[model samples]
Target chain A: MNLVFDPAWLPRLGQGVLLTVQLTLYCMGLGAVLGAVLGLVRVYGGGRWSPLYWVASAYIHFFRGTPLLVQLLGIYLGLPTAGILVGPFLAGLLAMTLNTAAYQAEYFRGAIQSVKSGQMMAARALGMSRAQAIGHVIMPQALRLIIPPWSNELIYMLKYSSIVSMTALRPETMDLFGVARSIAARNFRYFEVYILVALFYLAMVLILTVALRWVERRVRIPGLGTPGRGI
Target chain B: MALLRVENLHKRYGHEEVLKGVTLAQDAGETKVVIGPSGTGKSTLLRCINRLTEPDQGRVWLEDTEITSRRTDINRVRAKIGFVFQDFNLFTHLTSLDNVRLGLMKVRGMPRAAATGRAMAELERVGLAAKANAYPAQLSGGQQQRVSIARALAMDPKLILFDEPTSALDPELIGEVLSVMIQLARDGMTMIVVTHEMGFARSVADEIVFMEGGVIVEQGTPDKMFRSPEVPRTGEFLRKISDLYGESR
Candidate 1:
């Protein structure tokens, strides 16, 4: 038996994609802000002066240690048992944001460390306060180097956001596979529907990679980034 | 009071003392050159003076302001002391013009237009006006060092410290950087330069300080040190460098 046409399901799948896009973007945007703050605290905070270092370290370890599936479930299901209730979509969004933030912070810290120590000294020696130096000189250069890694996180987030759909809540916009499941329940054409959804994900990732590569080309310094080229 | 003073500056790292009781004073418009062998604390002394490297013990004064004192604002003192590094540590991301303009706009709070105008003049002084838009990686070593000098001069510092400014350049490139140093001296910029270029020392330096064993082993005027030095170590050091360069004097 051959798979039949499913034009009726196209609209449902489109809605699912819109939800996925929303979840990915919100998570990434808010995550990046949190991550940047966490990364800076890790890099500049030193012995006995900043207690935030321990907090950042612990956050990264916990989020990165547990699987994202457990995290989503913990927020959606476990919270209700503890008498702390949240809407399904809200729980998923919150979990994805924190999960993404922990990973992104590590990438940012690596990029920040790659910046030459001399850059800070030169700025401070000029009498720019430490904050001003980090803001103007250090962050500008670090931001450039981080593009390649940061975009990787964005791309990763697209796939990572899929776990939100598995939560007990049925967010209409977020469940691409649920659209396939609904179609499968009717026609039992499970393979064809899911394959179509897989194609959509592949296409999205492909487009994202090309766009990010273009940005890297436009902004990269000739000899000051990556290894061996910089001080 | 002297324009800049270092009193018995001392620094140690795990029992290895880098600078021991090093002291010096500079008057305004005076050009002092420090000569020393590698690992002999020449750089440490300069860094301590600017508080770039904190001395384990000592005091530094920039015209009656106790820079090393706990109450003193070190940033203000450092702003007045322009430091030119051996590697020409210009901010790599910015253009030559922006590097010079940074301090004026950020530290001094000058408007962008005024900072740009002053930065241009400083670059022109180093004969690099045409390359203001070039990034540090785009320029030659000599040009990059010159841009670093322009960055320092743009601050209108009370005194400039050159930490082996031309040591990383090629022999031919070294001459261009040295010439700029000489010109700054001629223009009456108070400078304390650390270099091995005997020619620059003899031509432009008011006082030549030879440092060894983390101490000011000898000090004399340029002519006196070069011709009839009182210290055997200073004479031997000069001969060794002259042999390496093959420039008989």
Candidate 2:
């Protein structure tokens, strides 16, 4: 087996990596907002006609239960069949956002429920409207609780973006995995190209994990410093 | 006219009746202390006053307004009846000052600056002015309870309901909170307190009502109720609680 090291390939890897990061950020931002709204509806929107909760639950079940690659394919290929044509970037964004919202919704629901019932009662006793109590009192504490799950979602979204490579036909928009596949085909050195791509992903994940862990530390409630850790 | 009146109040959880046709009334600026066994519906009665827990059947009147009849605009009545919880249910996310200021601003439509000023005064009254900027989590249980008092007092309500204000406190810390309540009572505040502190009831309450099995078993002036009780249940309860506190000490 012959291994050829190409120094110029670093620049291409960097560009592909940047595109992946951008896609992850966009997906996470949109997904988090949608998931939070849905989560709130599930918890507080009384009565049986909670459309947001039902739609959100179905979306989460469908996306989380299915493979990301299949979801990417369905959105990119299956949508065009229904006369709804979308570009590769838009399709990738849509798929990732939908997938992320499902997982993030569970995170938000858990966080919101963790807040003590006394907090809401206190707000109401203070003459705050139900909406004001949720917005002013419950959500602030819920936001702190949601941070850990959101950080996990961020990393998951980053890894999941790789599945978009299957449908992302445009060269400029192709992510690291797709770029690696094309390079492997040209050089006939599948092992070398794949290994480099794997190394890049490992490095990205390592950096992100450390950054998020630090953020978790900073945002954690003072007395509640990391569950199971001794005072 | 009575400042507050509760008629035929009945609350049931499943088959268990918590408050069984209990009724009471209070004059303006009157202080009433409700004493009862653990599950005799003293807390439930206080909760029903603010609609924190809805009663199965009841009519609660605040002055002329039928609070229980018009359920849609109960916030108006609620604004005039401040409630304090045993657990000092201060919003952990907000500072002590913010907790007090929220009702004034949201319910009374006070300007932010004016609300802050009034909140500061209330905190000062409760001896928590120095800790106004601190979160509930940062404050001790006593301080948190004081902040809860401040939060209720800031609204300048016609009545304040306290549900075991010192029940969830340390022995030494109970004095400070009770002291604040004594001062509020002296200032002619119409307050209903559900408390185990018979000492506080004896000191500050104009009337003491003893509840048992969801009914007011005995009610009279503290001097008559405690020193020379008319009801056997009241004497028994007092003896048991006094023995428990004595043993704890």
The best candidate in terms of DockQ: 1
The 10 consecutive residues of candidate 1 chain B with the worst lDDT sum are B240-249
Interface RMSD of each: 1.4, 1.8
lDDT of 1 by residue, A115-231 (tens): 989898899889888899999999989888888888888888888777766763353735666566777777888888888989988888888889988988888775555566546
Off by over 4 Å in 1: A48-50, A81-83, A171-173, A222-231, B246-249
Candidate 1 global lDDT: 0.88
Q: State how far residue B245 of model 1 sits from its true place (Å).
A: 3.5
Question: Who wins the lDDT comparison?
Answer: 1
On a 0 to 1 DockQ scale, where is model 2?
0.54
User: What TM-score against the true fold does each predicted structure earn?
Assistant: 0.95, 0.93
Clashing pairs for model 2 are: none
- DockQ scores of all models, one per candidate: 0.68, 0.54
Candidate 1 chain A least-lDDT 10 residues: A168-177
Q: Per-model C-alpha lDDT, please?
A: 0.88, 0.86
